[model samples]
Target: MDGYVMRLNQFISHNAKYSRREADILIEQGRVNIEKTKANTKSVLLEGQRVFIDGKYVKPKDEELYTVIVYHKPKGELVSKKDDRGRRVVYDTLGGKYMHFVPIGRLDFASEGVLLLTDNKKVAQSLMESDLEREYIIKINGKITEEMIRAMNEGIHIENASTGAHQKSKIYSMTFAPFIRYEIGKNDIHFSKLKVTIMEGKNRELRRFFAHFKADVMDLRRIRYGWINLNALPVGKIRFLNKDEYKQLHQFMGKIGKIDSFISKNNI
Candidate 1:
């Protein structure tokens, strides 16, 4: 029970599919159940419980060797498991079989950035749960004020509510305060091109932040996340983590558990 586990509802949220409340509605309609019991909407899930949703057996995804891929997703590509409209997908560019992985976090279809895709559910869950930092290179038209920085760093009240109850739209982790670190000279005027960092991976949070200030995001890109950086990966291209980089990621997670030991012993 010490390892990765989540309630039936939380499992849905973690999958990036739907919210917990929505999961509950599915449960109430007898669409989901834990073991053989009708799911208690608020019941806590212990490790190693067999679950089912809509007659499909639920299992935490498992793939070979905790693979992590850094995808330089270009704009207009969807980050979904499958695109209904048959538009270009990130996986389509990956080519061949990749063991059906899921993205660790998301970037809007219109935004371009570094996105993490992996088949290791635990690794994905830990990255979302841990206090690891994320860095972004944001380009916006107009000036950024001190108060705006303060609000971005301290957390912004997203114009609309999110899946969770926290009114302080968790677009950022407490580890980072929003600040503009750089400004490039454009036609003798100091324009804003800021490098910001945070941990929370809220959907469309970047666009929402600038929206609150009436500023338009000319371009937004996630350059780094925790120990990994998308230094030279070309847009729409991806590469798997070498053994050393994979080990380094485990170390950066603060020596959490036997995942490190397992990786070391197996050389994965």
Candidate 2:
């Protein structure tokens, strides 16, 4: 307990072994240990303690660099590490260079655009929790009307499947619809394109929100996340965040001086 004592799940995740949720699973399965004793999800590790996962030693990762990359994720690739059906994932397409990088948030398999990958779990967690904005370029199968936009902005109630009684099932509902700042683009009679920005990142939220309006999203691409934008970077390629980009990202996360400390510690 000399330097930094971190929670077991955080330590496991920070080592680039697994996500915090996955670490909890490993701990609950009795696969994690410290000093030959079974570890719990809430267990804390001292500065110099060694951790073993599945009887294999877990090495500490160098957190000094805190590398972040902006990846132009093309459609058809999952943001997950491995897929049950063996479909191509972002890692599969990235090869071995970013094996330890974790996606900040996710873009569904069918959606494409700017994706942030990082080795630092704290930074990733911070960004996910922050009120950072994301911009998307979407194409829907029908003309968007002012009423639809107003309803979306005012919020809509959607059925909550998770909250229902057995048998006769008294189903409940939840209000969704984040404020959508949008600009419509001229398109063919069958479809219309929109550039929309939202602050929250709910699971398939944009698609579900549009579905409420009876507007099917034919194409969806996220062009921006926080201060990071998918400028001219070619799809399927990744580039490290430049100095300004890193600074701006940290600023958005309210983590000023973090980049400087990382650079100084790693001498990068």
The best candidate in terms of TM-score: 2
lDDT string, candidate 2, 32-102, tens digits: 99978889977998878899998888888765458899999999999987778889999888876686788
lDDT of 1 by residue, 39-116 (tens): 878766777777788778766654335678888999988876566678877767876465256678777777787888
On a 0 to 100 scale, what is the lDDT of residue 29 in model 1? 88
Pairs of residues clashing in candidate 1: 153-177, 153-178
Model 2, residue 62: distance off in Å is 5.3
TM-score of each predicted structure versus truth: 0.62, 0.75
User: lDDT at 162 for candidate 2?
Assistant: 27
Against the reference, the lDDT scores of all candidates come to 0.68, 0.79
* Model 2: how far residue 163 lies from native, Å: 16
Consecutive 10-residue window with the lowest summed lDDT within model 1: 180-189
Off by over 4 Å in 1: 1-64, 158-191, 252-254, 258-268
